[model samples]
Target: MLRVHSENELQLNADVLVIGGGPAAAWAAWAAASQGVKVIVVDKGFLGTSGAAAASGNGIMAPTPENWDKVLSERYCLGKNLANLRWLERVIEKTWLSLPLVEDWGYRFPKENGESVRQSYYGLEYMRVLRKTLLRLGVQILDQSPALELLLADDGSVAGARGVQRQKHCTYTVRASAVVMANGGCAFLSKALGCNTNTGDGLLMAVEAGGELSSMEASNHYAISTAFNATVTRGVPFGWASYTDEAGNDLGGYINGRRDPSFLPNALLKGSVYARLDRATPEVKAVIERSHFIAFLPYKKAGIDPYTERVPVTLVLEGTVRGTGGIRIVNDSCATKVPGLYAAGDAASREFLSGLASGGGGPNAAWAISTGQWAGVGAAAFAKSLGASAHERVVYPVGQAGLRSQSNTVETFDSEEIVRGVQAQMFPLEKNYWRCEQGLLDSLASLETLWQQVQANPKQDTVSDVEFSRRAAALTAVARWAYFSALHRTETRSEHIRVDYPETDPNQRYYQATGGLDKLWVRRDWIKDAMSGDKPQNVKVVTGAIDISGKDVGAQGIAPLPRLSGHAQLISGDV
Candidate 1:
């Protein structure tokens, strides 16, 4: 068991600080430590057992040198020409190189026909190896320490971070030269396997620290899971499954050959939908069980064989955890607009690879490895330039809203109420999964009401309860950004479907960058214009405080975020 740091050691210094426990955080710590820099990784859970990847099976997207062109071409077309080709190429190359390092660390890949096949890996095994390797490389692992906010220097660059150690019931402050946000993405507390801790904590922290988010409209990704349980929703075994209505009638073209991802969600909206893997052959069934043992455990415990029995199914809203959207990175080094702050894995927007769509497993895994290394290298270089003087800079805690009451009224508010309110809007299939203008507007209104309450009263007096309070605020922030960006897009493209405007607009070939607290805003950056070095313009549609009318929610100004020193661009209106 990992022991908690001593009281005196709580407030410490490091060259690089990573805020996550998953593969991406481990890789970043490994990369930074390799450069002879002191690295510390703080996680919400145990290093090897946390995150979506640690609870399920995953595959990496690594193409051979000869197949690079063909793979990139297919992906480019699939992403509707919105992907950055160079970034995709780099991810492929870097991920291909990084996989061998895992094997060299003593993780033997399964062999077939006298050769090793390194396509997929079990979540537990992969994360355990990553944690072990990172520890061996002298990276400090601080488990059960969920970061609440980022510390910004007087010059507007990220200086360090502060969070509470859940087990110790004490606070921790790490003043580092650079910080990496690899803390995964929000799943709206959907109870997905390995995603309990992924509540957009880092996303909120980054945004509060004056970082911009991109492609958040593409965050409404849902996966098939057993209706009786919420933990096992990897969506792999469903490829061989057959779907049926409650009346036992075949729901043709639902799961097996379904092109539209929303087809099943639409069906479930009408009535209960059930699935069975009766179509899978014996060989395929064996493979499925072996690959997804955790997913089948629930079925076995319930005395049901999923391969033969009919089990009711529902769509699990993956949110941004499996979706493409997060803190927008400005360069290939995974550097965000804020200096000394980097984002990797699900914590960062994946639009450079998947555009307005989710890359599912393979691409996401490869992205984690590739981007993690780049961020680590970038952070190490920045720290080196700052040298020993890094700690001398005066820094301020930028946490607000959830940490303290934003209003003087101090209305009693429960964190659970905020979570339920956010989930009610995001989890329902009719609202977020298949969105229209009216539904979105209504949802936003309700969410804004909840957000106002959270800002007024977080209802946390103890350190351990701060995690829940922060989670509520983070989820609300993520939901608002997603909906605001969705409303701005107005056209159906990739995962962002607008029912009112049900056609992909050829002219609207742009990415939406969104961020703001009290007043949300979305900016449109045309693909061609961006390639031509043209500046993106904030859409004039809804600007200046999306006035929360008719609600008693008082006017709460945006939190005083650290003013950037002309090095970073503000996404929300002028500072």
Candidate 2:
């Protein structure tokens, strides 16, 4: 039954509720709804137009027919230190299956004279196809409704979520047997260069619900960043770029004849990085335009060829996409430790491609399609397994008291001021590309203070003010998590370079970090071949808990997580 409390408030029922309307949520909804499950998807923006998938610079990473062996080796075994090996294998396999479906739905990959061109980043086309597929399959999408918290039953199993409808200024409850936390990553604090809503909402929900986050310390993503734009990071892979200082000296070294993500940091040492493609062959330049020419499109609009001049770029702290550390899912199932809960896309710790490397041209695109479909099917199966519980229903009590507010007048201060303070504190060397013991400690102390200041105030005087408060709170949690995770890792690994440690300790791989704001720590049971005797008894490492305080959603009388063996419970079969 479609139960409406009023036009202002809504009480809906769904068998599977997929939060966030990105590729992950869309695929999950399609799978669940296609299987005759009632699925509802909620997002902070419009369905097809919202999220990073709608942005340019995303591709499917897979082995070309001729280079399958070499590409597979590079993606999984020999080239990168992958945590989920089987998961990566499945991703590659699923790429072949998913690509044809996307093509059928009208996603045009670049083609030249009847031959399909590779390295095309599907942005707008990808999201449109996904949204159309969901609508055709009867999946209900609720845009402009950002999920605020996860709703739990008597037991800890996920029972849907509570979110605010943007225009309505009202709260709604979605009752479902299973929930998919595909709300995406936490890069919004990078001034919307990433998705504007990528502020760790799903991460916050997972932690309060007792789920663990994995490999979070790997920070720093090289992008076409500057004073004005953040969207150009996606366009860098297919452009002719340069790095020069105030003196106009070339600083970027050839890592396969162009700038690579890893090399961007060093490129910044002497000067700023710039995208210069006006000098390249027309084919390459054409591909750049087709991909997301906005990097230099401004120059073109100004009647100046980009190659004639240089546009500056820099690096930023990021999660997912270019780095790791997200909700840990087992194998290729996308199922977490909590029953009826699954994570996909950037929200999950893919750990497929190793540290600091982004296999976006092909790998990341394949991951979004593959894992999303699997998670959808997995969530549907979970809903089916609930038996009578699957059909169980209750009109959850919704009220102003049940929800958290942004400002409390007395507790709240200026949101913009705090945001600027945070970004400034993070953009510097000590906590970013150049991390050290003292610098990390300094970063942690300052963030902790900011977190306390924010927590002391939770009031919403206006809609924008509330939005600002929510964004600030979410960013603070994400930043604190990243800093602590980086501090715990004692070795210089990939993008997570600890200058003081400076060496990639082989023994460090035996254990990986996983924790929440309540207690920051690491566990080793999941690490491959990490036996108890793997390390000598003489070594000492800090494993105690540190409180990264944010607003306590736990005040809602949330249930503690139950013990369940991951992978063992996975009812796996390709979707």
Candidate 3:
């Protein structure tokens, strides 16, 4: 049965409408509301649940008495000196300031030596911190409600978003002067997004409303537990383990294996077991072969259970880092090239990589929180300047003809089955430490065909159901873009590997190996138009590297070399 709400049924006008309820969303809402802006946040799950940060855990990296400067230097260098120095400095500053806010709100971090500890990295604490802050700030939370569409004004700026309360089956339009999309990436919705769960909905919506997207093609592939299912269930520290040949011969020692200096030239290693592995002479290899690999041991020494018993273990091929491509935001205040749109957390890119801390600590959650706050505050300020008149109504077809089709129902999606299939294919091909053109092309073709099947029979009914369909549509678009971008980049760099192009090409070294990079090239047209005072220009060139540093680092062998040939290929191209 379908239900319709007349225009008169709409309720609530807010200064900001935040979509998604993860840590990013929480901080965004809190930041905006704290600015005295009435904000409404809609989410698809309960607070403190879902989203990558929560699902995996949350941690903050701050300068403590122990190793403040060392951590900061490591983060800056990990970005390959290509990051925005000003933004990085701001984030580092904000991280320290925000820690007390989270603690005051309700969250607590692990302390050492009983001195109100300065630095302790853990993800769970980060989530708790954001949750407490949002609640304390008096932000109205509409959990289980997912945003369906970005309401655009006559001038094409985003005014608000329409949403559906799933449990109640009621439609509500949240009118706001500004919209902040803090929804996590579309990695989980691979079937719908056609790539990883990061469907690029926020980016796409912003783009459709004249916003721009950058670095869609880059994805971070961490070294996770490979024992049980090769799924990234647990984070593996590079210094924790070393890889051995099938014959049990130690290829490298743990200490020397931290990260091949040649591969990740900017990476830092301390107390690294992999480093020992790399420095291993024949005698060291022989000794290591007889000794138990310490990495396989549980984190029991650190008060955590051993991962090998709980999950699986695999040798760390390369040092883990954030995804290669990220959304580009040139402005100092986290504003995208678009006026009314802002991005933060994993979705925004300005040269900072997400996961890099001392001793294999997960992504610095405090940085994410602070960035969200910055974005939220900026968005609210922008909205305030626009005034109430800027708020616009979004008129959609509400007649019977607007009813959704039944084929798109969630009941039709075998998520587990689909996930298993995707994992099987991606784990070997795209997920391999090294990837090839043939495998990537095959994976893209197979996934595309599967996505087409899902699209051909999209489920529909009310706005809630339709939203799922829309997410699926967005997922397909993202996946197509990822695949298309991968197909075009013929060099091996970062996590993106092409077996056919096994060697990293000096000519293509500066280019991002993802489709989102292409979007950045196109975005220049907007910049040119803005500068020339002309109509928005559309410049499309198939191949050109982003000018991070005028000099090509690849020519100098500064970029990491691609390590292929160890992993197996996709199975029969079935997945």
Candidate 4:
């Protein structure tokens, strides 16, 4: 647990403390303040840009009734109904409402005849709407303030957070009755959170303070083009592909090497590729034949030649999806199992599937707005119930010593070098379209060794060097978790290809796992159980249950089985 300091240690008391300055944080702070609750928003970067949403070009995709129903059904079916249905419904319902709220705050959307036009499968226009809304709200925005730790009360409940304001060389703590962890997922915090940027800090804070996390193991993998190093470019929608030959011939056939175009229209539907392809048509077959179409099934999964042939083609980029399974929430009110804590946007989920629709004015941004607004209002109300005395207490600015501690302890490294290493490891041997148990094991071992070496010799100096160390730590954590998780799942599903376990077992049951649960013991059987699948006794229900006699589980019919255990705690070894 992070050490706590007195009120003199960090300054500023707020009714609601909102971490992150993304669309979610913006709405959260605005919503809380609108209720006349004192609020503060702390961000790791500049308010308008940075964070995951800033990197995202396309906004959330809104789901039509038919498409929405299909996506929801797919989530339930794939997740085996482990998902929280009410939360899903609430996200879908409030999406449209959130869009207009942002616009009313002064942001504009891409429109036709003054009405927003849907673009791509997920909406990409609501970004503008959010930007304008933030400016009008008068939120107390603190850019480039990355949170260091959760400040806990005497009883260990979450009170606020401690962080370093990089430019000031000082630590700042914003005390609050309730804190909303809208800081995007741990992708950036990979070193700290491990695998993906979800270091599970927010979840960890909630859990440490007696909150529970559900559906931690359900991550989504996106279909990125190998030839382009996954550089996403916008064009026509994903389902409607534009086929071209080396000579740039506009073949009279459709793009995307699938046998059915019907599923292409349903690309807007939120389901796995396997489910979408199951609804393919004969015309798609003709189109593939006519175009001499090469099947580019993103990275890894295409057979020998399909995997080897590095073809150049333009991607009709659709907006981004979580790719990781959606987070789990308990109710329509956006509350988690914990009382004073709330989560919104991608941070809270079991399904990991964001409820954004496919076209413009999509559901992604709308949900961020809606859920964030809800969390903010809820947090404010809860804070208010604590009475005016709570607000009377003064919050002190973080101490110089704490600031130095964070700056001196946090680590950062060469991100470019790490990215290159990750690409090389993922593409060639470990992530080959055809993965094998042996190859995966070998790759994981190598990654583990590398991580050990880095940890043993982690650079520690002054505050200025904190970022590098932090980054290095995050990268190692992410690599280790992803590699271990990939290695642990013995079956072939969705993006997890196992050459040895080539066929998807019809009766295999899937389970979801969360990390950092107190019930999980590092010294006892946790790690060993996870590696061997012994801990997931509850997952027997789905194993070997499906019938795949004549079905194509490889090319289609594959979905990611949940990892039934949480993350392994990091151990330090001397270099």
Top candidate, metric TM-score: 1
Which residue runs of candidate 1 sit more than 4 Å off their true CA positions?
Answer: 1-9, 254-259, 529-575
Ranking by lDDT: 1, 2, 3, 4
Q: What tens-digit string does per-residue lDDT give for candidate 4 at 1-575?
A: 12322234447788888876667777788788889877788877766665445544444545655577776566434433223344456666666555565556554556778777433211223444454555566557677776655665554445777676667755677778888877554433222101233333344444444543333222323232323334433221224344334454433333475434222223323221211122235676454323222233332353423222323432122111232322234444466545556777655542323211121123445557677888888888878887766644443322111122333334533434544454454434224334565554555555554444343323334333443444444434444444444454466654345667766543333322333321221111011111123223434232111111211122211123332322223221100
* lDDT scores in order: 0.82, 0.63, 0.50, 0.46
Model 4 ranges off by over 4 Å:
1-10, 63-85, 110-132, 135-138, 186-321, 325-328, 336-339, 350-367, 388-429, 432-464, 483-511, 517-575
Model 2, range 264-344, lDDT digits (tens) per residue? 666566455665544567787766566565555555555655666666555555555556667766534688767788988
RMSD in angstroms, all models?
7.4, 8.3, 10.1, 11.5
Could you tell me every candidate's TM-score relative to the true structure?
Answer: 0.90, 0.83, 0.69, 0.62
Model 4 is weakest, by summed lDDT over 10 consecutive residues, at 521-530
Please, what's the RMSD in Å of model 3?
10.1
Instruction: Give lDDT tens digits, candidate 3, residues 446-473.
Output: 6655454443434454555555555654
**Model 1 lDDT tens row, 153-205:** 98999999988887787788999999999999888888898888899998899
